[model samples]
Target: MQTAASKAPAFRAASMALPVGILTLITLMVLPIPAVMLDVFFVLNIALSVAVLMAAMNAMKPLDFSSFPSVLLFATLLRLALNVASTRVVLVSGHEGAGAAGDVIESFGQFLVGGNFAVGIFVFVILLIINMIVITKGAGRVSEVSARFTLDALPGKQMAIDSDIAAGLMTSDEAKARRAEVATEADFYGAMDGASKFVKGDAIAALLILAVNIIAGFCLGMISHGLTAAEAAESYITLAVGDALVAQVPALLLSIAAAVIVTRVTDKSDLAGHIGGQFSDPRSWMPVAVVMGALGMIPAMPQSVFLPAAAIAGYLAWHLKKRAAQPEPVAEAPPVSPDRITMEDVSDRTLITIEMGYGLVHLVDKAKGAPLVARITGVRRQLSQTFGFIVPQFRVRDSLDIDANAYRVLLGGVHIGGATIRNARVLAIDIGDVREGHAIEGEPTFDPSFGCPALWIEESERDHATAEGFLTVDPSTVIATHLDQLLSRRPDALLGPEEVRALLDTVKEDSPGLIEAIHPDPLSLSKLTRVLRALLADGISLAHPLPVLSSLALALQQTQDFEALIDRVRIDMGGWIVGKICPYGEVLPVVTLDARLESAILQGMRDPATGQPIIEPDLAGMIGERLARISADLAQRDTPANTPALVVQPPARRALNALVRARAPDCVVMALAELPTSQAVEVIAVIGAEEEQAEPQNARQEELAA
Candidate 1:
């Protein structure tokens, strides 16, 4: 089966590869190199321009994909018309050259500034501008254009063009700008980092050699060739296979550089960010074209193989770089907010800081205890040191730190948390005073929403808490205050006892072990009961199990009902254990009942009819209580009875057998007659003729035997 993750990259790669392949194949086959070089370059020009148009479309406040098809079709038709015009001019000039080289040259000169070719270029430029207007007026509709191309053609790649970029796209500078965009976005350096490890330092050495060889190739062509600089540059390609080996240097560099940049950009920003940022600006990218163009000026390289090719490379690198830098203005605006700002009105150096906390760590020790660790974000990275935690924590792809503190922390647009001066630390003084830093310096401390003023605690040499100085905070106040705040936020007027009980029941189903482990003590139980009652007053019902277990245990302690409490707990736990061990649920009920009986025997039971407590009688209570106590000894919850060892008083089985077998009535039987008439009658129903009930009670007998 194909997983969702694995399918993503493949989709993205295919999208980009298709367009490049289509245009490159067409340009290579039919068009002669000299005549059609610029036209071929235009295909790349179109792709870059489209990316900018895409950026602007993205700027719209809300992103929707309704009008993608119409926009793409319009853009494609305009581009195709320009391609045909450019192609005809080149073809006509070639035929005109059939008369003579001079005639062909003249024809080319005429086509450069006027006539059919010039008219076609003019139409193409108009079409490009019109496309931009449509994008702007349509609101966010332009994004759909690029999106359609990507979804229908390129999977992961995103194209965005804003007004500024769309304007630039019509200009001749588009190609040059794109090259620079590609260079900046490229990540060959990172790939070199990974690739270096496999070969150790060998990859670095190879790159250095390649760079040297390229420069040397230029030098050799300059020094040895008798031809003029440009002609000699062309002759350089005529060298032996060994010289060809030197030509491979530039090829290797191009491949490695391209791979590195593509991989890094794809990994970090995806094709969208990489392309958007670089293509957004053109001026910053001019230097890369200068470098490639200068390199191409080296003598002795084949014109047939290198001149136009080098120029094309230069154009591409420049185009990509510029496009990535410039972002298109979206036709639509983001939803209105107090913090919103218009793009054109903003200065380049203006810095906006947003305060927040992001990374959340849930730590589980022994698989049963859950503790939480959250880092305050958007502060100085160095602040992490003072707080005694690692910096730059990342899980998945999101950095945990809040980007800014000024924005505050909003849960559903209501402020729930904020960082104070005390929670922050100064990392770099030279970076200038931040608002938070200013607060920190003036007050010496400020507490965050979730924190109180810092308390004095001795630091241990080791990182973890030690037994000697562990903090034992009374959780009642903390729990109560937080609970009250939580309930107040709810729309309901109040919670009720039954609702509280239902919440406990839900918790029991999902986290049975957690509920068992949190059994409250007497004081905690009383507080919890009050909290529940408060919830009831407020009209919310929540009778949580932790409080109930604690209350029941406390009541048992006072009423001498400890044995019954223990028995009920045994019966409850037996069902869970049997369910875990048995694949089939059939035998689980029987297992549960037997556990209850065993508990009853060991804990001992009193007959209410006689108003007397029986010990080690013909009944199973003696042994059952002993077993229940033994089971309690093996318990793992927070309850105190879960000791590692216990002493079980053996039941008097001989007396029990005699009581069932004897025809004479014993004093124990006569004692039942002294009870109230109603209770006495019920006792008779309960302790029926032992011999008659023996067959059905055999399983009960076995539990007592334990």
Candidate 2:
């Protein structure tokens, strides 16, 4: 239903509002005749010329004259040369109404010598000062505009596509294809934007010249064409104005309009900054044209209009100067300490020693690089009792089969043990081809059922000693063992006294600084505990949590980044901590130790009525009982303050009951560890909901009792 005439009223309303305001202001301002007569016209002419040169140069290529004195000097020299040349050209061409260049030169000399020159010179100096102020003030406008333009030019479609990809709303391939299409659009827009700059540059120049001519033509027509401002007010006044409201107003308005429009368009694009990267962009040239036009119009405008034009130019320059003075914002990140050796820094040799067991060494030798190894049957038994293993222990009487190709150590020629095979630590390796299941896989496929069988060793000076103690070979004690004979000859021959002292000194110096920087303060325990609970909820294991939690606690205590600590914790604990934990607080523990001791009582001897020293008495039963009691006491001492606590939260805990029902419909084991028999029974009752669900039916009761 909208018509062309309907839009007409809106357009006219916008056009008239500005002119009316200008007119009203002009009428209110009253000036003295003599004050205006102080060679004001000449001063304005000079100011306009200066503005023209500056704007033109700026648009040609953004000027950075503030920091570099040479650039400013070069510009000044060019301006002076151009001014002189213009004067000479006008006089030679007879455009100045002079027969010779000498006459024009003489006139210039006369003006300089005469009183008007002093006033003009003073005004020109004032103009220069004002221009300098403006230059320093508005420099940031270019950067600001450039920033806006950059954001605007970014393809919105691409941004959306990226968001969708991040939010898991789109397939990876689709996102990539869409991003490529978005890039194509950006390139097209960029090309058009470059062309706009040149157009803008030229248009600004034309506008300035037009303004000067309009003012000159109006004055000329009023004085000599018998067309005064009063009668020439009706049509669009392309000439200077005097008394008639429309005549003077529109001409001035048009000139200001042209300048303002150029300023705005150039600002939005920030062509000034772009000039460094792309001199071909049209916006770069627009400022140059504006500058040139202003310079040419210097001698043409009336004092009243010309003065204001000069003032505006000066203001613009000030803005540039202020912007130049502003500083940029900088992002500060958390500081990292260089003192700590993380899990990654642990040595391969150290890890192997810890995993294989360490107390069976007989001797060590470094003279010929031989490491002698011995196995103790008693220690192997002790290890088996303390830490449960499905495979036979390394024995002093047997040789260990070392699978170097697979980076695995095997006992009984079947049970593979070690971190190198499961972890990504075999940096230098070779894979052989095979058609069967034994073929080496180049990249291990992700398996949810697979767990990392890697061991993390702490950095310490005791690795060598520990390694010496653990290599055993007793046919019954170990399935196999390899003793490095050269290393077994002499352990003291590894490093001399001086080298050992130096190593000790270095450690001494670094240890304190490292501890100060990496160890968590006791005061941050509460915060660390909260973070630990959060990690637990995210499925991190209790056995592995301490190391990660320590790292986080240290980072927090040292006032380091919380986010960085979180990220570090994630890295150390594996990405699983980023996921959810199931009910019953039942995240699987990384590893568990069996601390039970078995009895070793001797069998009965012959009954001969002789009592004293007849046979070795059996003490194994008593020893076993005492050992069991000792273990129990130790466990009680290690018990947490809130142990046997129930996790009764609704959905999270209930899920455990459901899972247990599905997995072990008849098996029941209370969630809490190391509880008294009575307490454990109570826990079973709660988990099974005995009162309502009935006591755990057969197998469940047996598991609870066990």
Candidate 3:
């Protein structure tokens, strides 16, 4: 058992480590210290500097020694404080001898400088120059540059982390840790940049203190003690030089430590390990061994030194060569029994995947600050909001089988779409009306998202391309835009039963009673999913969940037929539909069917048996062709290819919508009953006429006979 007496010293030492150390430094600066106490403090200063150097050398990375800057500050202060204490002791007692200041200083003066005051002065100045001019200056410069670059690259690093998180490659906890490490690295380098100034100032202060002590000691010695001028000079200058050397040596050690740390890369291994591994190759040693051996044989050279050095290099070269020649041992795999194979061996396929060729792999490389990952995250977020469900995480991977510049978007292991992108070039998409001559010379291709013509130009030509009225985008944006378009077109395929339940659970919070009133009775969750999928299939948004839920609940109570229920819900969602098609205070651009064609379509939908319209092939074919033509014309007139509304009577709306969806899916087919009264209509084009249907009818009959 430990007694109180045994633990008291350890406890006191632990408790006094910071506060007492600071107080002692303050006391040493303020009051004169005796030679013996000064000697002890000087020794402590040297030991602290050595400890700092060893710690710096052993650190695996800069962040591992994050407190180094503060440690450097404290060490510099301790040395300066010791300088003051020793300066006072030396100036007051230098009339006696070189040993007047302290044993540490006295020994440095007599033993290190051989008791010559001039030699001590010369050595002190040399150490001061090395610390102030070379090591400290270089370290300070490295710290400044590191801090600036770290701060400049902070945003890119943070973006990379967020992209990794969005890509599901990093967990939230891992991202948080990485962000903290980045912040610590920036702070450490910034502190070092400031802390380096302390070392420089300490060196200058040592010089000033030495000069003061020597000059003051000489005057006091001659005036008060009645000593000769030469004797006074010798005694005072010797102690002063010793004091300067004692302080400067530790300053030099710390300066070296600072340089080592600031210049160190964030490698996994320590300095020694890194150096040993780098120099391990026999090829590198062989050249040095040969050069040393040749030098050892030269006439008039110091063979005693050179031969041994050559011999050591030769031995290192031979040892390294033999080690390189040895075969690497491989571990044997454990035996597997066929009967023990399980389903766990098979990997499940991802719902969505973006596979790129080798050349385009940099678009997902975190080190390169790839913007594609972040852009894809934004696309997913926007699609989720528009489609009323969370899009699955996209898996980005590389494939060697694809073309070097090509990337494929895969949905459920099937290739949906792909595009070729130049990693070092920007795609300038022409938005119509760009003259051929004005555009720069480059590889011309169609934009993958919409098939608009685009030019692949060097990054430096981006400004010129933009000035020529082309929209400039990087490879990442091009891929993300293409993916967005593909996802937008296939919203129905993305929504499943899980997304349906999520939607219900989300809306239940706002109207819990309403959600409870309509489930499993009038409408099952499966039926609701189908209805929602139908709405999303036609470019409708489900952002307003409460309204959608309320509409669904109201419609389900009146009809058991899923088709009729969806139509009622669409009618109930007129305000939202109208708002999406036509902005507030703007008239809706609509295409109306010719009177005769409208009547035929109504007659076709009069079947009471299946609730599905079965039109004649000729009439259906004619209507599809006319609608597609009208949609194309309207798209050309609109700036961004706005969806043209095909207005019809409420009875024929469902039949007409089905007809148009099969042909021109981009057109919006709205019923007269579904149009919001607040919005006005502008008839832009007419869809069909009697004469237009006649030719298709005759051709269809001929084809059938054939």
Candidate 4:
């Protein structure tokens, strides 16, 4: 069963059809075929042409027949090759009789024109005219125009799909499908423009082949076969005309098929149904009936034919009019009740929402280009790349309850931050370098993102503010930066089990064994989510989950105690966490608790439920205050580290983390076990040591070196 399933698609009919068809077409052009085989091919050619025509008519839209161009190419080749084959036999066998080529051609030559060579010539010329001058030419022109217009509109169609995605009206999968469809439509029309040339050239080839057959057969019959003018004309001319007609009929059918394909307007119904539906309208047939009846009354017109057509038209109009007069079944207007409440009405599905007042609505409006919305989209994309998962879509909506110029960011229905904006005004933030009382006239305010002193300046004063050593930004940038500042610190608040599951599914595709070792076995989803959240709060990003999970998987081999599991993962990942802040080829500027101070904090208080250490209130306050001051000093002085990290024993890292983050959030906390020995450190500050208990300056230097 398994072998059969694996081998099924290896031997498909479509896989062999193209090669077999091409070989047959080549054989017809080069090799001589018997009359029986020639008859079979002729019937097949007629059948194939009719199939193409029916396929074109049945297509509901142009894209549904996207393969028409290639199909037309193959069909045109087959017919021309058949022409080459039939021409070979006719010139060689014309002196024998009408039956020399095959019955298909013999019947066409003898029966189609009643064995009259002149009538067959006239009939063949008429088909050439219709196929070349009418159908092929018109279809080519339509294809060229369609290709030009489609190429012109390509950029706009792509932009519209992107806009829908940014506006949150379409999902990623839906956008991909829409983009593929637009590209396919363009390619199809361009191919048709080229393919129409094949049909036109085929028609010309048919006419030239006919002329060659008649002239060559005439000369050969009289000179070589000892036949007279009347006998030669009867034998050769009839066969030449018959061969032309046989190929011409299919060529005409294909020309009509190409025209049908190019001219079709996209509709819900196929060609037959669309045309029938349009004629079913009573108003259109009423005019038709009147015109037919008027023509039938004229004596010069054929009364027998025109009168019945007029009567048939009248009956169609009357029947359509009666159907139109019958009232459609009414649905009783659905009882005019109040709209029933659904879960979507009251519950907010959006994980993050930007609710603004009426005045700030223009910031998110689509017609004005939605500057704020675009920025928000960029922020979402950047964060998703940073965090290695798609951040949920943010919803921007207007509310009457807030101040007209204010907009607020929400996470899971909880207010994160709200700030007021001065519409049309730019905020020039003072980055602590502006000289005292430099004269720049504007309204004074604090920059909402970081509380830096800023001025809401008019657009004209932008250069003046820049000259005064202030960084300038528009209203949209202010909101986006503020949102980034607030959200970048709270990644765990944004991550959930759904996001973790998505990450797991992604990693499973690349490294399945790593996931199977840790997930749904030692750690269920709920437990795994808790562990990841703790890692995120401890300053580890899931952006590169492979390394993080790789460390976790190794740790699971030792122990599954929840707290022990977290600590082991952190210790394994510590060198990475510290490398992010400290510039390369320089010592990491470190702060640590004095050995005695850490001992006191470790032994002070414990949570009764979890048995984890809690910090003494007074000591926690002193540590936060000292770390905050050291962080400020580090910012001004030259240092390898961007921020000071508090390194303590493993037991006290979490308690000190909450404490240091409260006052100086930029400062990172790490355990002594977490830091790698290869990374040299400079002990810049040490918390809680007396003049006597503290180690000497030289001793402290040696302590950091060790």
> lDDT tens digits, residues 534-651, model 4?
8877778888999999999999999999889999998998888888878766788888777788888778779898777888787778888999898999988876676987887788
> Which model, 2 or 3, shows the larger TM-score?
3
Q: Candidate 4 has what TM-score?
A: 0.54
Candidate 2 lDDT over 444-517, as tens digits, reads 32211123221222223124223433121112122122112111111222223332333334433745543234
* Cα TM-score per model: 0.19, 0.21, 0.49, 0.54
Candidate 4 — what's its lDDT? Answer: 0.88
lDDT of 3 by residue, 1-706 (tens): 9999999999999998999889999999999878889888888999999999999999998888999999998998899889888888887888888777878988998999999999999899999999999999999999999999999999999999999999899999999999999999999999999999999999999899988988898899899998899998889988999889999999999999999999887688998898899999888877887888798899888888888888888889899999989998888988889788667567535688999999998889999897899999999999998787888789999999899989999998889999888779999999886766894868989999988999899999999988888999999999999999888878888888788888888878877888787765555878778888887775567777778878878887788676677778888888788777667777667766766777776676456785655677787788788778877777777433266788777767777777788787777888777776666666655556445354553443232223
Question: 1 or 3: which has the higher TM-score?
Answer: 3
Candidate 1 off by > 4 Å:
1-66, 97-706
The collision pairs in model 3 are none
**In model 2, where do residues sit more than 4 Å from their true spots?**
1-40, 48-271, 279-706
Error of 1 at 294 (Å): 30
Error of 1 at 419 (Å): 35
Candidate 3 differs from the real structure by a C-alpha RMSD in angstroms, to one decimal, of 18.7
Displacement of the residue 402 alpha carbon in candidate 4, Å: 1.5
How should the candidates be ordered by TM-score, best one leading? 4, 3, 2, 1
So what's the TM-score on candidate 3? 0.49
